[model samples]
Target: MDVKRWLEGVQPRPATATFIAEALSRKAGVKFSLEDVGMGGVITPATLELGLEYTAAAPKVGSQLLGLTRRDLAEDPLAVEATVVPSAWTQPLLTWLLSRPEPLPAGNGIQVNVGDSDIRAVRMTTQLFMKLDFQFGGGHARAALAQYYVRDVSPLLEGKFTEAVGRELFSAAAEVAQLLGWTAYDLGRHGLAQRYMIQALRLAQAAGDRMLGGRLLGNMSHQANYLGSFQQSIQLARAAQEGSKGIASSTTMASFLAMEARAHAGNGDDRACSYAFREAEKIFDSRNIGDDPEWISYFDEAELAGEGAHCFRDLRKPLIAQEFAGHCLELTDPFYARTLSFIRLVQAATYVHQSEPCQAVALATEAIEIAGSLKSKRYLRYVSDLCTDLAEYRETHDVGRFLEMVATKYPAL
Candidate 1:
């Protein structure tokens, strides 16, 4: 039956009719199962392992990407609820280190022709989504991005285009895929995020974009650190630096080094973290933004400062963490609520470490207020961590009030 017939309450319901109900549920913000929509029978969920491999071949990369995107569109439960497998990071990191960029596959006799204009439009749309992600957090437009990828960008990959156009198109697709992974990570969907990042790395390799590929590895390292896979995170960061050594711009390289520093801090390696931070700062000092790719434009002074703040916080350097956090707050754009909230939490944690509960409460309250508008699970986790840090001073009046406020606002925590 046609979709219109289903909407019009047709008598016979097809076995595949659940998709319509799923779409309606998402749109109306109301739960609708197959039974609720008058469609019966179970729909098997997509497997969690569908897109985890880092395929050495370009064609397989495309296939994996398609599979993952389709699963996302179908709203499979596993896509959102799958648990993180830290062991999955091992194979992808090894594959990236051992493999080189593969040549673009020839078109399969499709008559469709993709041009520069098509590539430009894809890039513009990607930029708009990226801006929304930075300003409003990843939960805002992730589904819309997935839909756009399936509807528009997927076909261009199979269509005929010149070598130049193909490279640009693949690069654009990689950006979108990376953003998808980032949004998933922000939502605390680590399994989905890992799959997207792995596919994105392959796409970047297909585009012969070593710089972007390195950045993707850095992203993996960041996620690994978040998951407490600190050793894997450090290894991935080193792989990113080694893989893109000669070609990466100063800003890109600095970002990679900072990721290394972050992983080191997570592992409690103070000396190694300090060395990496010094190198990142030196490289960033000499950077000329004009020479960098537009994708790396977000790694300015504020970003570097924020990274430092995170590193110091992890390394237990409370005073230095406060200094870096303060700098980051001063320089960050107000539109980036997520970033601001994270920095505020870092600053508040530093105060807790310094035995200043009142000051910590003030900063943490500000952070909570800023983050209240976001739909980020990661931010909530950060808030919970700060509250844990403040436990030693829970008897104090300010700390008690702060705990009450948090319990009132976020009973789940």
Candidate 2:
């Protein structure tokens, strides 16, 4: 169980790997080995053993756990290609952790006073950043969050508090960490996003929040799909579905199903994608607002339409893509500027697929203009992809003008 030794043996070590090694080795006394642990490569319930058995009186980082195999410890752990959904081995562990009556202390050297009001303040501030991310872009809000997470929130985990307050505080911190992961994804920092996601999941587990954990898994699925890691995407999406089980609201399940549909579309399984999409729609239609969690309230019909647009676009159905994209545009709020820009980019790309360069140029022009007012790397990424596709039709006057405008206005896009 020489964790540091195993970590040092990794070839072409990732920065994430190094950080995990240093943090775990220094923060806790427990040691884990690949051969000694089950399901060690994943962030599962078995990982809880690391923090739960520490009785040496030294404080720890709440109860957030880290799980990685010996091989994962010795190689590139983030290689998510061909990754499969894990068996529900963590369920019993989750139950045990949730059944605990006492709140775990924070990591050694973390000394800060925390109260319920402090947790509420963090939640309110987090909501503001979340709104900014929805409207302005992740680039506008991520730096402030990164600093707050490290300097302000991290210490609060170890702060003195009653058990109820501690759990609530952990939950709040977990939500903020998830937002940080999302913003990182929006900023095109995929690797950093993955790390944040892993940490967020661990925090959720510590907080005994199953729905939040499922949402984080779903986010990972979304990122994997965008990166063309379709297998992992499906695996993660299904994992979200199964892990949440009785805990996830119907809308949340619909979101997970929608994500799985996108992964299936990426794999060219049209029938499977269609089936999942229909099932998602059915579940969404049956939603009861009172039973829904606030975290999943955003997955309404408009969001589902956006997913449909992406699915049809990937399936080479330009007409269907435009139909869904148009629906998304109609339902999207003007305040959701980033989402609107993204859907417009999809619509413009659909026009390109239809061989209508003039329409594509016009739509792309509007999307680029919207993006100009935002600081989202994700939005710019869509614009850049559209530019690459439009290059084929650059001989057309509209396309030519589009290219020139893009070069002039967004030189780095």
Candidate 3:
């Protein structure tokens, strides 16, 4: 019954493990799935391999999405243990790129008609939730978003609508599902995030929203890069670019290219990273915001700078990283706490790379202070990584004080 023992790798009873995982997740500001804590038992390879496929048909995508959401609502343990299969990435990317968008099939269930007003309402609600996600962390209103999706949005998918309304409805639903995935990713629930993203991509495809589909693939690329699957990340980004070619607005293309640059930087391919970064900058500079889809309105200069900062930080170009990070911090909205925290961490890491332990510790402490207000595991990990970077300087007075402060604030770290 000692939680400390469970933290030390002692496996508890399944039911006990579930409670412990939830408790630990809350305490640590990171989601700990049953499998993450070693409570998952005898997971079949088949069950482990769910949610990887990129289906060709719209109906199949809808069915899969419903199943995913239902299992998520029920808190099914297997849903938490879903594996991130490396081989799964390539085929799906290929399928999505090679296939054309499928038309929305006729809805069968209820006679209820989903009109443009309903679609507009869904978009407005999703935009509000997206703003919440930006201002607060994903853990803030993720449950509410999920509940809304299941309760309100899911039914609309089954209702009768004209071809135009159906397309708009599916696109709006995809946006919600994509937000669900983004929230899960922010909470460090990568498996669940992957599942939602896959479904979102399918829904976007069904809606014939090529730009949105590309954006979903870019989301997958971002997640894959975060999970250290750099090659997969690169492929996913490229797939996004290829799949949306000629159609994607400049901003969306730039975002996809930025994701590719991130993957290249993570893989230590400096030349490739530089090439991609240049392309992203060029496209972004020429972007006509008026021509972009509503969903891609978030990828502005600040976001692009953040991505550049991350790329340079990973590539060990501290000076350039610091430059980009500074611009990102200046341009980013104060309401975007999580993003600012991340950019601050990137700046802190640049200081560490410059061998300025005192400056690094000061900046990192500030980042941790900002992160303290959020519930993002990824932000915590960023703080932890800064701590790791400062490990070599632990003997220094500034770093020692910083470490003590971190211990006081986040004992789990």
Candidate 4:
């Protein structure tokens, strides 16, 4: 947490034993015992080579999260790996370090040589902390943090950490990928989000977050539903519930179950949807609010109603769907804003299903504003569905105008 140590010109390297192993330590179970590893230790351009080896050799490897434990074929035995993800300025920093190398007696501490290898390592390590923030917090803040660090602090690192330091940095890069996936998910960018989420899942697997891995499955399930892969979504959700049964938050568990209900609704199984909804509701009712992690924290009485509305709408039960949709509020948090729009879009779909385009257009118009703010294509897809529903009500002038407006905005329409 002492980010200051990274801010250079300050010497007298900290004691070795106290060092945190960023990504590797998370896997190592205990903090790394950084006994001063002296000469002849060749560093790589990618710290992952070392981290992966460390992961593969650990005693409880396969029993752990990541299926990948060993280093890949691309790794070099003698070459020290660093990060490419860091900014260009960091390269000069290593040049400076490598140019002024001195033995400088590291009696009781680990000595970090100034070199490309070390600077790259520090960049990777910093990203790891950024990832930790994302796992605990939400995406907007995490993305903001990642952008800030990658652009700002990254320049100063200049890759001058020891192999131990490089390993630490690589861990951070994996963690960032994990968080980026979550951030993308919360933003409604289904396709791009999926890429980030899968990579994040992989990284967490490597980082040994069994709980995070399960959560990743839960996220994948949500994306599956958005893409109409409902069956796949349900299976993934169930997998998450089973995988992290003992460790995940009750809210997270319940949210996965709720997503499964949506999958059931997508498949037109009202019975299954109802069943899952009941279970999710029971869990939500029992828990105290604000205890849930922010990832699923958006699911509350109002949001659950909106979700139910979607299920009922999908199942063609307009009356029931409208009942739930009526209860959902107008939320505005940047992350939840798009979701709120989706809920309204679903509600609009329900109205359209019932042949009520006036209400559908009205709700959709509001939802469109929220969607327009997002860089997501899913919103446009939902709107396209809305326009399809609106064709049924083209007689009215206002409806015609709104339809025209949507048409103008999306030439694809």
Candidate 5:
């Protein structure tokens, strides 16, 4: 349909808006209802293209995505579908980005003296968004952070600051970028999330924050695994392990090892997965209070246990997976509604593997209810997976009802 070009030339009619929304749905990997498109509002193609372009982000911006602004991005008027195929900003873009020299200002421009307070404010905002992301889901937080990043943080990078201050600002900005990537991933925007994470890694590197950079790599690995690129996931995890060898705390190391374990489990390498799990536990037990980086402080025993359950589930060890998943559910806080929902889904998957269809359906129902309250496509993805697992048992009355219930609750699924 060449939506970008079409919108440039014609005002969007109701039928055209509906058509565009449907087109976005087809691209997003999920269905979208006609009501999703805003009628009577002018469709902004440039903004839409920008959002779509982010799905496959370039390593280095020739210029900060020409003609974007806080207001234009803040509302995300393009209503771009989430499922578009990533463009040039995928693997090749990452390769070129890594091979390129570090970013340096081209020439002296307007010097807006940046200070510690400015950097601190950015970090604080990042922390707040991180908490929000945990509670609600990436679907809600990603755009908010992106808007702020473009409006507030991006300029600081190009502004005049001392080398030390610049590094600090970059570090803070990198954290924001990392969260944006993570939230994007949570919303099922894998390619876009990858680009954001890679950019975050570069910013972290410029800040000399090896530990943060390593975490970013681990995050990338996590996404790669989700995308079914297990070998690439393993390589990225190993990079995280090596990159943060001395600088990272026990909790961070545990996270890296757990990520590697997941990739191994995905590959059916139970033995290798077990090895990584053991090392993760050993390092995790060795941690002292407050030793972990703020970024990885969430990788506590509960988080590790959840990962353990995930690994064992992938290995088809239903009993062991259930045990670990149960522990995670118990230890996780209620305020982390989205995390709790995911853990519940893991528990449900374990039940399905055990042939406890009734229990699985019940747990899945609970997860869906949780998902219903949040805007998280990732949580819904879990629900969709649960439906897939239950497909074999469709003849059972309970399973059939469960599937029907899910379809009713999430038509987009």
Candidate 6:
């Protein structure tokens, strides 16, 4: 019978439908219970064209559904043996299918089936983004993705997926959030960026993806370090290091450890900082440095060395920091302007710390020139540090000339 005819045939007793609904909700996945809507589900409102209002999500306890009576299902309201498929039915598939401009023609597809709270959300999330990555045509696409995929796709990764699947998915989702967080951070939306990174961390945890969690923590630590929260940054970075110990990507793991060292330097924990850096350096000695997870493949030896330089500068080891900094300066790409600018500022600071004020000013001047064309407040902050450090040198006309030029050149920095 049509839904209208079926509804008309079934009559409710003088009570609310609440009892049945609550029972059904509690037993949403059950089969053989009146709760098993897959037996013959139906919907109200007479508008839904989809088949079945609900489906069997799980076998009922003792093989019996709670709300249904065997007799008079079509003849009686309580026995109406028909299930009402929830509005949530196949919604995930429909959403996924629609998101694509060209879904595979009806032969076969790779869409993960939602099976009774058994879908591993993280793995599906990674696959969704990776499959579509071909659309971006990578010269250099930032890996930050929207929260829709994180929140929606995560539902697919809830249950007992394989360990490898969990690891891969969580790692990808975390990377997406980290990259997006970085962009948002660069754009100055501190609060929104924090939310995404934190959520990324939670998803990583759910997927048992410790390294992914570590990466998320590292992302947060970097932001904290930038904001001058040296103590907080160190704490977060330490947590990242601990979480990433056994992951496939030693290089990325090592970089996180190095970032922790940098934070410790900010906190003036020189011994702690040095030890961490040494540990990070040892990871590079492994033969398979290049065989890490794709998300962290960018953390080459040079990048680690550059970061080590920053850590050393924090530790007051000027000579070591400068050695690495000089190497990084030669190897860096122009597109990586912000990191290069940061390295330059640190070099200038190193000079200042060493009390070579003239050399400091010279190096700072050069850094300012490079920063002149960039639009990062972070870059400007470094320039301002140079100016502040050199405030005592206002005696010279060159200082006045420099300040005037800085005012014109970095007004928005």
Candidate 5 clashes between residue pairs 3 or more apart in a chain or in different chains: 27-83, 28-83
Compared with the true structure, what per-residue lDDT tens digits does model 3 show for residues 270-382? 99999999999999999899998877877899999999999999999999999999999999988788898899989989998999989987887777677667888888899
TM-score computed on alpha carbons, candidate 6: 0.59
Q: Local error of candidate 4 at 325, Å?
A: 1.9
| Model 2 lDDT tens row, 229-322 | 8887888888888877887888988999999999999988889998999999998899887887666767778999999998988888899999
lDDT, residue 166, model 6: 45
lDDT of 2 at 175: 84
Candidate 5 error regions (>4 Å): 1-111
lDDT of 1 at 93: 73
> Residues 25-94, candidate 4, lDDT per residue (tens digit)?
6766655422222211222223222222312222222112121111111122221122212122122222
**Higher TM-score: candidate 1 or 3?**
1
Clashes of each: 0, 2, 0, 21, 2, 21
**Roughly what TM-score does model 2 have, to 2 decimal places?**
0.76
lDDT of 3 at 404: 92
| Model 5 error, position 153 (Å) | 0.8
Judging by TM-score against the true structure, name the best candidate: 1
Kindly report which residue stretches of model 1 are placed more than 4 angstroms away from their true locations once superposed: 1-47, 109-111
Of candidates 3 and 1, the better by lDDT: 1
Candidates ranked by TM-score, best first? 1, 3, 5, 2, 6, 4
Say which candidate scores most in lDDT. 1
Model 6 residue 374 CA deviation (Å) reads: 2.9
In candidate 3, stretches whose alpha carbon ends up further than 4 angstroms from where it belongs are 1-50
Give lDDT per model, in order: 0.84, 0.71, 0.84, 0.54, 0.72, 0.54
TM-score of 4: 0.59
The lDDT of model 1 is 0.84
Q: lDDT per residue, candidate 5, 1-413, as tens digits?
A: 65675556544654566777778888997876433543324334433344323222222331222122232343343332323332322442244224333553322337566789999899889988988888888877566777787768777766777766766876787798788778878877665565566567666776667778778878877887877778888888888887667778888888999999999999889999999999999999998757765666677778999999989999999898888888888888777788778888988998999888889999888876765568777788788888999899999999999999888878998
